[model samples]
Target: MKKYISLFLLSSILVITSCDERFEELNTDPNRPGGSVFDPNLLLPTATFQHGDLITGYSGPILFQSMWIQALASTSTGGANYYSNADKYVASPSTPNYIEGNWNVGFSLSSRLNQMQILAQQRGLNNLNAVGQIMKVSALSVVADTYGDIPYSEALQAQQGISQPKYDSQADVYNKMLSDLEAALNSLSASGDQLRNDVMYRGDITKWRKFGYSLMLKLGLRLTKVNASGAQSWVQKAVAGGVFTSADDDALVPSDEANGYSNSSANALNVPDDIYEVRWSKLMIDYLKNTNDPRLRIVAEVPPAGLAANRNGLVVGNNDPAVQIGLPNGFDLRGGSFDISNHPNFPGATGSGGDVAIIGAYSRPTAIYRRRNAPVFLLTYAEVQLLLADAAVRGFVPGSAADFYRQGVLGAFTSMAKFGGETVSASAATAYINANPLNVSSANASLKMINEQIWATTSLFANFLEAWNNWKRTGFPELTPVNFPGNFSSGQIPRRQPYPAGESSTNGESLRAAVTRMGGDNWITRTWWDGGN
Candidate 1:
């Protein structure tokens, strides 16, 4: 009996060994390549979606940039003030989590894009490689714009044994971005096969090319203050290369409520906590109302109900542009003091009751602003036209600045109709453009007008970070700095955000060196292109 059991055990062991030898082969799906092989098509969608998520996500634009630009204001006071730190410019001991999250998202996407580029190159897929390069440029630009000096040259070089990469100057990063974009534009051909999972342009190589050139135009405009000659050269190159001529070529991320791929603004601001706490800033509301801008009704909503009703239940407001009132920045719910009599038409609580009056009287964003599946515009034809207007004003491109400016205004209204629903018709857009035509007489005046228009056009779905950067570069719209107590920058708007604190422990030497080179790792420290206050 012992001999028979030993033979059975030996047979079982042999059978197990045989199965182990063929295990990987049997489990591997022939349709899907496992392990080393990567499909660029599959990777493209991930990069694109992440890029959209990062730009519109709370971490990147909605929370910081939008507030910085004064397009949105926080109503929370005391302990419950969620974004009070950002609004008041109170410097924490370390970088905010959202800023760090934005940095990580950009670099992570870049790393994946690097892998996609290598695989695409090996496969002789030029268009795929170009797309990867374009994405890499876009991702790294966000990093540069956010933190000034960052890991650029040696970034994502883990395969080459580079764990701790040194920081590169913002100028170098911008130059490299331009070069990579130019190369991408050159590599893309009409004959090349279309991308399988392109979310921005479907499979249209022409639109892709236009998007690249438009991005180049934007980057070129960023250097206007720091490197005027360089800015002109690149702007001219972008104009000659061709850019988005119409709304059809606009780079937008389509939203789907079913799959949880919704608009980032709605995701961040539509929640009950944020909806009641966040309202339109006095600056944005005043500007639109004063200009008689048709977009006001689409962007803002009136106060919900009477003071008693508001306290009982959170009843929403009507979408009347005339009744909208923006909340002033630098005031918390308890600290806010407004003249209630000024807004007799306001449906919310009247009289002077501090938090109740301020919170219940001021206009919050409209439902369109909080729509679940509203598409987020990445880069639009309006932006391209505005950039061209700037270039033309600077004598870098042909055509009158007024012409491009008018086109920009018209394009912005037309594109924004998507969010405004059926109410914002083409005739309404044309009428608005006609009413507010570019009437500046001189170049400097034209620049100021153009940039101010750019500011308003970029307020809603367009990239607010770019608007903040534009404000930093041009000093247009003339925003007054909030002088809250315990503010970080001596009551001035911050020039750049601090680097993440984790870098001090993980990449200590490089981070210290960057801080030293950048003067200090504080918010007041300006980037290479800021040209100081």
Candidate 2:
């Protein structure tokens, strides 16, 4: 009995000693850095890369906005029927999956950025915190813009025990985004720690400031339809704070293809189905052709003879302007009434018999766009210049709308060379600008011309979502909505995408409240910034 009690006491003493002295030491992970030691700079690259991927991805932009804005069109029949979600405004089996993309990815990234901000603040890393703020807004803006009323103020607070974030109004979201952006832009200091993991600007704080301001300009312009005075105020603020002055200042994040990170846009375009079916829209090509835009040949190509070659992703096509014809939207390959063969003024298919190339004559995007390592352009100097042009026309800023327009045109032409294609000569670009000068005869005419250029520029750059968003805001280059049978929007263009179906199950009450506030959770419902009450 005495021996047993002694043994038990010895074990108990050992455990008590271990708990008091070595418990926390053993629990501490030697490999992991604590909050103070971990560098917040590491978070910026992740947010940057993921955002680049999100925008350029197959689901978010490619399957929806790319066709919605008539930048690219596909025959939604047979092997390519999945494209009906985009081209025909019709749902596919995977439509629910696609709808969840922006909400799921965007909020998750915003949460990561918010985490970075918290850590940076704890460590007194002001520059990193500022970058985090800007990036968080960028991520959240995509969600808010796409779905209308998204969880903004209470979003990304899962760590704070708020699992179901209440959706904020789009107007409130925009106001908060603008305020956050302004504060962040003003906080950037060149003297701070070098951003070791920055993939966008290589730790160039000045360029980051420019990017923030440019984004602010865009967000401000979105309010033009709803609050013109607010738009003017923010536009002036952006200009005064400085904006992208050159192509070099454009925000681009290159895909880490060598590390197995494929450029999603390029990956999607290179897919057999997309490559075989997707082509430049007639709406897009007609405007480019009518203006004799220098980019028409450089950005488009007609595939070689036969179905095999057309479907062959390796074959570079003829880029001659005369050979480039755009495919009409809402057509199909079912060989029925809606077939491309039956369409008016059909530019006959290329091959015959079993090797027939149905869409061979229509202009497909150039091979440069399919390169796996292609840089994702976030925002560019061309867009900034053009937006400034619009502001100028509206008397929101002091400048010649024509000069700003000219700069925008020139910037766009210069930026096109980044695709590793034939460069439009500076002289040729200048000539085009001079030939198609901004229609300064009246404010409306000038606004129309400026925004039309914006549409064209964004389209050619493959920034399809921005193109669609701008169209919604400005109503320029008025697109003819395809009234396909059984479209979700009753022949009207979709104003906003529906919230993901899962929200109804997971965040049911909040989702219901937002749906009610937004009038209804459907495609035709306009957002608050889109002039909806």
Candidate 3:
């Protein structure tokens, strides 16, 4: 009994001695620096790369927007068809998956950016904070554009105990984005240590400023229909702040061959069998061919053995500018008269030797675009130039709209060559611009011509969402609506995607209110900036 009591006393003493007040300090992980506080540099690349991927990735642009804009078409039938309903203006269950994916990506990336901003402010890392702010706005802008109202002010505030954030109006979101961009620009400086992981611009503070201002230009133009005075003010402000002046200042994210990090369009269009299913749409091909645009050869290619024998080392039909054929939208294999043998350029002998009218015979994306490492263009100088041309037409900026228009066309051609792995000579670009000068006789005609050129230029980058947005704003290109039976929106093209269905359960009240405010969460509901055109 005495021995047991002595042992118990010794154990109690040991426990008491081990109980230090700084227990957490003693156990602190040496591996983790500044626990729970991440370096802003580390977070910058993640936010930029993920934001770029989300915007240019499969779910956001390639799958829906590209098809809607008639840049690409679905050739598969039944279960294998991914964009059948989307191409035909019919709703499908998979759409919400895409919506949710985009929503999650935007918010998830912004959450990290929010953390980085807070940490940077604490550390007096002003430039890093500015980068984070710009990225946050960029990520959220996609969300707001995609779904009208979204949680903005109250978003990324879970640590403050606000679990369910309220959705801000689209107008409010845009206003906030513009204000945030301006704040970021003001905070940025070349004096400080730049972000080490700045993947887009590689720590070039001037380019970052230009990127922010370019975003301002885009957002400002977005308000043209709804707020002309506001648009003019912001456009002028952006130009004064120094927008992208050349292709060298284009904001592009270099992609690797990895699955998630690879180019989104290439991922969708470069597969062995899947590549055959996707081809240039009739809208894009016909427009390029009719206009005698030099970009057509760079953007598209004929299938193997689809044309006559090789001539002068050229791949015959594949390389010949005249032999390209685009498959019509809203058609399956049987629906489209895809019999290559019946094609006028078919070089097969009589009926016995012709190539089958299948996926291989149609014009597909160019080889350069299918490469694994093709860079993803986030925003380009050409787009800014085109916007400037529009602003000039509105008399919002001082410049010849025709000259800006020509510059925009040239910029687009130059930028596209980087992706197509083709060399478009300056002379060729100049010749094309000379041939297709902007018609400036009437304001209406000039605006229409500029917007039409915007459409064509945007298609080269597969910038479908922006193209659709511009089409909605200016009503140019006059795309024929798909009239498939049982189609949603009465055979009209979708104006917006429906909110993710999961939002109904997780954020029901907020989601319901947003839907009510937007006048219903269907595809045809015009967003705040849409102006109901």
lDDT of each: 0.74, 0.82, 0.73
Question: Any idea how many clashes model 2 has?
Answer: 0
The lDDT-based order of candidates, best leading, equals 2, 1, 3
The runs of at least 3 residues in candidate 3 whose Cα sits more than 4 Å from the true structure, single-residue gaps closed, are 1-31, 35-38, 91-93, 258-260, 305-317, 334-360
Candidate 3 C-alpha error for residue 26, in Å: 16
Better of 1 and 2 by TM-score: 2
For candidate 1, the TM-score is: 0.87
- Candidate 2 wrong stretches, greater than 4 Å: 1-31, 78-80
Residue 227 of model 3, lDDT score = 93
lDDT of 1 by residue, 128-181 (tens): 899889878987887788789999888888667788899988888888889989
Q: lDDT tens string, model 2, 448-483?
A: 988888988988888888888888888887788987
Steric collisions counted per model = 0, 0, 0
Residues forming the 10-long window of minimal summed lDDT in candidate 3: 1-10
Who wins the TM-score comparison? 2
* TM-score, cand. 2 vs. native: 0.93
lDDT of 2: 0.82
